[model samples]
Target: MCGIVGLFIKNPELESELGRHVSAMLLEMSERGPDSAGAAVYRNEVDSGRIKLTLFSSQAQPDWSAFDRQLRDFDAQSTVKPHLNHAVVETSKSLQQMQTWLQSHAEVRINSSGKKIEIYKEKGSPASFIDSFKVADYTGTHALGHTRMATESAVTTEHSHPFSTGDDLCLVHNGSLSNHNRLRENLRSRGISFQTDNDSEVAAGYLNWRLQEGDGLDDALHHAVEDLDGFYTFAIGTREGFAVLRDPIGCKPAIIAETDDWAAMSSEYRAIAQLPGAAKAKIWEPEPAKIYSWQRQ
Candidate 1:
């Protein structure tokens, strides 16, 4: 089992400790997945779009010092440090150029040019890595987090959740898909690259394929449910907001909470109940095969 949580605050300028809120939820579910934990925070700045690059490996040790040396020259704000078996870099650049620059770095995956989208994830307990690096120090109104306990694959930074298919698009999932191997083969045959052996990557590839064919986020997600087999709960995030959906069978758990200022969701009611102002809040599980769309307004 895995734990997934996400929230979108209405006011970007508001002084809500979103990082703290999300980390708390993630930690609350620590026992669910002690193997790894991660959180992505979204920020909106004047006009300088931000980018996120995740560098991970089990065979090669990432040289963050060298990487920092490479991007220090860019005329943009950036943050870099060690993350379990990887390094996360947040910068400002066009997606094409960033992808081109990272083509040679097999250990790196770049998500470029969106609102402040900084992904902080690692292969360990939530407290272990989340504290080593003050990821919460970077503020954002909307964010997503995941605590992963690998059921069918090796544990590595590459297999962490909140996998981004594009600059602002990320997907966090719970539940095992019985047809992942077949789906993985299908995706590879279609020329999609996969870094991890986890089934969630298949979900990411499905979304990427849909977007490549010009489908919007909502349609892409709707299509994914029909195209994918097995039980799953996916919290898909975009630049504006996020969408949550479950397979028709409702094999996995998920809960949603809405307030005048925020919308938070998690794989369980306990995580949602942990949110501020949620002590007496009403929370409900979205029906199976139904989609719940929450905007950042």
Candidate 2:
């Protein structure tokens, strides 16, 4: 089992408070998953043609300056900001070529990439990790977070949740998948690669593959309900929206609340209760096999 939370700010004036709202929701779900925590935030785009990539290193202190110089050699203007063992790199190079360059560097792993997304994750309590990362201070239009209980995988930073397989797209899962190995193999044959053995990562890759094939986020999730076999609830984040989905059986717990300013979902209602307008928000449990999405207007 795991905990998942997502917040999408529909009101432009409330965009600056996205992180605070999400952080509080995540903290409320801490007991559901105490092993590791992760979050993906979609902030303002740096530039029209630039992309942001979050990279993680196993070392205590990575040589970010050296990596920046290497990117410059490829004619990519870049800037790096180190936070704990991970760094966020914004560059004006093509994502495909940057990924190829990163593959040649064994020490650095790309955690997430997009024009407006930045992912941060670590192997520790969600509360403590939030404090260290100052997640509440971030400003963005939408955010998704995960707290892992480590049922199928080891407790490591690489195995954390909110896996990102496409630019500005991320997924956080709250249940187990029975046929993930089979599905992973199928995706691999289609040229999709995975960083960890976690089933959540495979789910993220599946959605990424579908989107790459020209399916919209809603269509991709609708297909997931028919193709993937398991009991799961997923909260997916994209560059322009957020989506929530559940298996046909709907065994996993989930609740959603939407106000004029924002839409929020969590594993439990308590997580959403403390939001800005919870009392007046429309709250309900999402139906099984239905995709609930909120997009920026």
For candidate 2, lDDT tens digit of each residue in 180-243?
8999999999989988888888888899899889998888998888888888999998898888
- Global local distance difference test of model 1: 0.76
TM-score of each: 0.87, 0.96
Q: Candidate 2, which ten residues in sequence have the lowest lDDT sum?
A: 68-77
Candidate 2, which segments miss by more than 4 Å at Cα?
none
172-194: candidate 1 lDDT, tens digit per residue: 89888888898889888887778
**Model 2 TM:** 0.96
**Cα distance off (Å), candidate 2, residue 257:** 0.2
Please name the candidate that would achieve the greatest TM-score relative to the true structure.
2
Best by lDDT: 2
| Pairs in steric clash, model 1 | none
TM-score of 1: 0.87
